[model samples]
Target: MNRKPSTIPVPVLMMIGIVAISFSSIFIKWSAAPASIQGMYRLLFTSLLMLPFARPYSGALFALRKKDWIMLIASGIMLALHFLLWMGSLKFTSVASSTMIMALEPVFIMLGAYFLFKEKTAVSALLGMGIAIAGVIFIGWGDIGISANNLKGDILSIGGTAAVAVHMLIGQKVVVRMPSYLYSLIVFISASFVFAIYNLLMGIPFFDYPPREWGIFMLLAVVPTVFGHILFNWLLQFVSATTVSMNILGEPVGASILAYLLLGEQLTGLQWTGSLLVMCGLAAYLYAGRKKGKDIAPVLDNAS
Candidate 1:
């Protein structure tokens, strides 16, 4: 693939996106609203905030083909399913089991991308993925529980990972065909719609949250949804979906640091070691990409 470097390197941008999303857990912890309700409002606010900036692509957005709309909607639903399934899993299983399973997202994405997009990853990159996944397993190893009770949660987490992998693969297809923000706008709206339906079905109050909760929702939208997810969405046009998914491994590391400083949570020795391994794996992955040439491809100027 012929490519040119962007103003900022892909690794740096990926780091920034990871840091931005690291705030998501903190914000969620601070909020008191139902999970689906918080998700609905966060997505709703993100789409609304993106509207003004998307004016330039308004015409192209409307001109999107039927297939584009179908893919976008399917992508959005998968994203919502990810949240729903992951959150539901937490209630039934240990956090360690759930998180460790969720960390397999990149593997799921890698397989899908390989088959569907005909993308091939290098041996070093696959090794990097293995190391990163090993790091995650180690981070949660102490608390991992295997029991009949945990089976359901494990399955749910697996489902969630699959859902997100599909969501990412869809984004890889759709984001390249149009401007990123415009593509994300439709996805955010579609996801918010799904979340709204979930909220209604669960009988979660829509407007009963206090100001603090609202503030948390807004922060969720701005930080993670826009800066985190939208940034990742924008990145899909340049990098392979598996590469983007691999970058997500950094989120747990970032979140652990933030949890330490902000939430007064203490990191165990295993966590510190796990974080180191994750960083090393990411470094190796970047090296593999660089070795193969084409770090960040030049954006195709297709407004449609």
Candidate 2:
């Protein structure tokens, strides 16, 4: 008889990865670079950092099929767009507004799966999504009614959320057929090309970024983008999108705490309460779904 390998629980891995990714906002804020410049460096540096590990010329990256290449490039461009929009949001609106709105990416994913892909959703997951959305609503309310001056930031954040949703859906389809590291390599390489072209067209100075800025950018590429995403992509091998979405409840909480500690950003009591509600609902959803054993949703196999 063949033996199956025992694996670490997927939820634990997802939690850790999501927590690591949450630190990204803190690093970006600390860097204090322009959003476009930050977006450019993020892809460029992450590509360089990951290339050594992925060994793209070892026939790994090129081994992908034509269709896979298409999806990989699309996902990469969408990721670049997400980074650009969300980072720009920082300049226009409060962090609370941006994080809260971007948190709705999962909701968009759920909607897309239902309408676009015809994937079935569990009642528990739906309920959890609803409760989590309420928490988001409260957080958004807290951040809203600021000056109309911040409207551009709010719009950018929403656009970022849409980009994120598209990226996740496309990735779910692409990742199963290839190793996550290779998939990430293709995506990052494509995104770097897009950023390079955009920087050239905009006449933005892409080089000679200060050393301190370069150091921060390097940390950003290594820590959140490389480590966090690698782990998250690995978790997808064992987990469902709903499971991943549930884990996202931690991002805002982790971000809020880090912001307070590192950036002197304070959270109001209401925001804390809202954050807690998000966690509770996500916990309930995951628990209920996993108990049924049919928790993992069906991903579209055709993309691979």
Candidate 3:
């Protein structure tokens, strides 16, 4: 698959994608609804917006090989769980802690590769993972650190991060076979159904959300889904995957800033230190990719 440079300036695309993805945590916080509901409407609206473009690739969706179907379904499930778990964490934890926990993602990806794909990490990367985890412990353990609720949020955030990493892994397996938009469309719609089923089983009301809630839902769809993950995925052909992956490190910083300005949230000293440590460790882990000649593949946006 021969790929050309993006017609748009790559830095401009990077800024747009980073700023867009960063708002995902803020959007989730803006909503008063369940995470499943927010994810449902976000992905559903995303699917609708893609319908115009999807017509061309709709056939490929059906023509997927059996392995592709399995991969797509598993990818969809992981994506759904990622949102459901991660967004829920925001209710109980500070945006700083939650996003800092997401910084553990590269660690999860490395571990996943070791177990699932038999990939090995160098000692340097392993030490980096340890530093990052210790940082997250500080983040999650701020003043009143032993609060069970905060711990629950931290756990949920970790689960969410791991889920999305698996989503990316499964996506790595099948994405090359078809167009990205088509694969995304199939996965998003599948995730929508997962939320739908969950809502039904949990007896959560649907379609009764107020107008502002509806607006937030659409914002989640457009801001993060379209402008964030979709744009980041598209940018892969034009830039190094490491370039794109590194921009994701901005989420903890960006989201924390947004949280302070919009949500009146302030990070404790420990949280600030943890946030810095997380970035340093994850940055080190990602650069190790250079030595191995393998960057993390394009990832699904978890903050989204």
Candidate 4:
């Protein structure tokens, strides 16, 4: 007998995902490893952790259509690029600048949706997005500089933003048909393989790191990779890609707070105001989404 799959509330999952991912920047900052090496370990560890749950759905994996595999592969590669470029940017720029630039991903996602899906965005949603972006800019006001290195970092962060936007756009289309666990496992494995190859080609060692670095790698996998990204992937089955991307705007607020508390990075008065603006923008965005009849309740109820 066929049975419907049980589901969690999408909003709850999104909140958890946001909180989990907010820790990602902090984790990256704490690690002493190369960006590629850290990325490889993060994805590799996540793939291993997901293997057990994913094994139960092995039959479904073989049953995926060719087009699905293509999308998954592309999404996985893009995901790898997003991490590599964004992490690399962190090496050259302030976390505030890097994260604020990366926050522009929703703009790319919205553009892709309009061109590919013929999706029309609401005015209120657009306003909310603008406000959120403005808030991030304000938060990063003093941090962003025009030096050559900062320019390079900004470009890399923008590249990462584009990569993730494409990944999420593909995910929205594919996750509707693929089981979340199976989808996550395949994508994680694909990214891990790509990063592993990149690390090897760049002469980045896969091992011999200190125990603290290993622990940081493991935390990266468990917190940001597993709970953060995997949860977002699951939510893609319910929410629009733009919505998912917009939710990520919350990351800057959380990341800023975490940086201040843990890393002793002080926040300025302008940054505090910007943080409030970000929260307001997010609330308006979600409220506007609901007003436009884009609630996830029906989607959750219909999931099988």
Best by TM-score: 3
lDDT (tens digit, per residue) of candidate 4 on 137-235: 665554443356765776787788888778878888888887766776788778888898888888888887999999999998888756776666566
- Each candidate's TM vs. the true structure? 0.75, 0.79, 0.92, 0.79
Candidate 4 regions exceeding 4 Å error are 1-19, 136-141, 145-151, 226-250, 267-279, 295-304
Q: Write down the lDDT that model 4 would get.
A: 0.72
Best to worst by TM-score, what's the order? Answer: 3, 2, 4, 1
Q: Give a tens-digit lDDT track for model 2, residues 1-304.
A: 2433328766566667666777877777777677767877777787787667765446755677899989988997887888888888777765655665666665677777788799777788789778877775655555554555455776787788888678878888998888766776677778778777777888888876789998887877777765576665555556555565454556766677777787787655656566666666667656666776644342211000
Instruction: Output the lDDT of residue 138, model 1.
Output: 54
Backbone clash total, candidate 2? 0
Which residue pairs clash within candidate 3?
Answer: none
lDDT of each: 0.69, 0.68, 0.83, 0.72
RMSD of each: 5.5, 4.8, 2.2, 5.5
Using lDDT, give the best candidate's number: 3
lDDT string for model 1 (1-304, tens) is: 5555667899898888888877776676566676677777877887888778887898888888999999989988987887777656655554444554565665677779888978999999789877866765555543343445556766776788888888877887888788766776788789899998888888888898788988998998888766776677677767775576555556666766776687665545665565566566666766676688635321111000
- Measured with C-alpha atoms, the lDDT of residue 92 in candidate 4 is 69
Q: How accurate is candidate 2 locally (lDDT)?
A: 0.68
Pairs in clash, predicted candidate 2: none
Pick the winner on lDDT between candidates 1 and 4.
Answer: 4
**What's model 1's TM-score?**
0.75
Summed backbone clashes in each candidate are: 0, 0, 0, 0
